[model samples]
Target: MNLQKFSLEQLASFVQGKAVGQTEMQLDGLASLTQADAHKLAFVNADKYLDQANQSKAGALIVTEELRAHITSQQNFIVVENPYLAFAILTHVFEKKHTAQGIEATAQIHASAIISDTAYIGHYAVIGEHCVVGDETVIQSHCHIDDGVEIGKQCFIDSHVVLTGHCKLGNRVRIHANTVIGGEGFGFAPYKGKWHRIAQLGSVLIGNDVRIGSNCSIDRGALDDTIIEDGVILDNLVQIAHNVKVGANTAMAAKCGVAGSTTIGKNCIFAGAVGVVGHINIADNVTVTGMSMVTKSISEAGSYSSGTPMLESLHWKRAAVRFKQLADAPLTQMLKRLDHMQAQIESLESTFKLRK
Candidate 1:
């Protein structure tokens, strides 16, 4: 029997789903409905994509209850509560597992540091004094784990990543290459016509299953710890400023910046290059679109966007001119124009009354 090929019955049992058609048909891999082959499985999540799913050439389809009516008799399918989530589970099952074991001889480890026997410390990696590295954790090459840091089990710290100043990370945390945690925040005070730097006295607290991408900077707080709650995913070049409390399961895309002291609630999604101002509270389940500038606190859960949409140069120039004129237009002149129009209407009404 082929290791990759599984019967539709076995697939449904694996995903804990209900089979709609012939369960004896075999499947090899997963693919998009538009590109799926006879051996692959395709999934439909939205109502708009139901027609495409029904017309797909895949041997098997995974769909929600809303899409069951659209499927034709020729299709072999599985009905699940959430097709997209079920597909996500399948991706994990198909993922290649890499297990790294044993510390490299080239690593610079302090005698006072505590490292698990099962952990893998890569070449040129630095483990500072009093630091704790948990079991099965892989610290990749050139990583710097500073003094008093605590990293839990099964965590993956990628190459050149820096965890400074007693930072803490829970189990299964993943930090990609060149990401810096516990760097000093941008805090300054005016003193004698010069700026005085405020000491960054706190570290970063990253909860379980948090994955931070490459080149991202999470600054150390001025006083309290900069906390990233469980399941927070930060994309590449993302800037999470000091004293920020990112609630659980919030995902931020590439180049998104959250200013200092902001409290972002759970399940919030920030698209690429979105900016959130300091001292603001963003409610749960809020989604900010790409390149949006959030200048204030959001009190409700909804999609929020800012910045003007892209327009043609000529049309934008004309609109810009009109926008500038609106500010220059006098209130008295607007009231006068309204009064004159009302007078004209009244005169027209009198003329109609005379004609009648």
Candidate 2:
């Protein structure tokens, strides 16, 4: 927790933001507004948290341009285009550097594997035959990298992760603990009333700058490689099925599952617990809200949501009953009969007006 201190002006310059109020104010660490003291920095990105910002005892704050006018506090602050993004960048600057360096003697590395001198292989990590691990890549303890797996420079494969089936990783990719990449997919064939297991013959191709969270399971393709393009982010416990091609810069939140052969477009954002059906094409820049089930393809880029809104149990049951009955009701014929009665009433009203 002994982070290097940075003055308000220096941090603002580093993040390419504008510093306002006390430029000489020093901040040693970051904290939330409610938890911050006088020496800590905090940020307010939305209006809902503005009240807490005003009451915070922190020495400095990061704020967006839209939120700048709302601050009445005397605390030193920096106004940026996006305060949250600036905060995220600063978190990297304040992160502690890994102390582990070089390969441990207990690691099992095959003679055919090509590992760089700068890479750190932890104790008990197994590197299989013909594997290529690039410079400065960290293969943490208990990680099992299978035969012919290629990992590019500066990638971090955390502990207990299994990279099998000749998967490929591009530069600076980060895979968290307990994740399994290029595992056998859910493929099967039916013959004579029994299921036959289909061999997953493909691999997984992960692009640069992708960060996958802990406990994720990414299945290998049945024939073609499953592709996860550059800058794609996957949260914890996400399930990516076989042959699914996740486009560049797309982000998926926790517990989201994509079925096999789905082609998700670039820059799309899927919120928590979103499920996408197989073989569907999602257009670029689409945003799926939390807990929505996408059963079909999306051709247009926009925010989409499904699932009924929460209601009381009694009211929900009543609505559900009526909804089920709608299929059997002749709604079109009922509307036509109502229209005819309305026309007759209008004619009678016209005659009464004429007699009057």
lDDT of 1 by residue, 77-136 (tens): 888999988898887665655577888999999999999999999999999999999999
lDDT of 1: 0.91
Give the number of colliding residue pairs in candidate 2: 0
> Which stretches in model 1 have alpha-carbon errors above 4 Å?
1-7, 19-26, 50-57, 65-69, 73-75, 329-356
The per-model lDDT (C-alpha) reads: 0.91, 0.93
Report the number of the highest-TM-score candidate.
2
| Residue lDDT tens for model 2, 317-343 | 999988887765587678889999999
TM-score of each: 0.84, 0.89
Pairs of residues clashing in candidate 1: none
Give lDDT: candidate 2, residue 130.
99
